[model samples]
Target: MSESTTPLVWLVIRKDDNGNRYRIGSYATKAEAQQIADRLDDRGPKQLYWVERAGQGGAQ
Candidate 1:
């Protein structure tokens, strides 16, 4: 598929106290992913949330 037609996914990542990181969710847009991250971040400081763009090959 062409670049323009290739599906892009924005990931909301969470890092825990033990330094373990994983994907919280995948969104079609960065704004959506950021929203989720921001909401989760406001819960507390124990865990950190951030948004990242998935690689073209679907890897983080």
Candidate 2:
């Protein structure tokens, strides 16, 4: 079987004290997402990640 070549993206995930997660935005690279997370560092606690999507236009 052949694998897909879908490009990966970096997502900025923000979780509040209530444990609710929000997908703020998607970036082309991990560094780009990290920059946004750094800026929001003072706002609250959050997590950064690089996720590989499924086939073209696959659902999250």
- lDDT by candidate, in order shown: 0.79, 0.56
Assess candidate 2 and give its lDDT: 0.56
lDDT of 2 by residue, 1-60 (tens): 223443446676665666565667776667777777678875534443223322223233
Off by over 4 Å in 1: 1-8, 56-60
What TM-score quantifies how close candidate 1 is to the native fold?
A: 0.74
Model 2's number of clashes is 0
Q: What are the per-residue Cα lDDT tens digits for candidate 1 across 18-58? A: 87888898887899889888999888666878888886433
Q: Output the lDDT of residue 17, model 2.
A: 61
Candidate 2 regions exceeding 4 Å error are 1-8, 44-60
Count the clashes in each prediction: 0, 0
Each prediction's RMSD over C-alphas, in Å, is: 5.3, 8.1
Query: C-alpha displacement of 9 in model 1, angstroms?
Result: 1.0
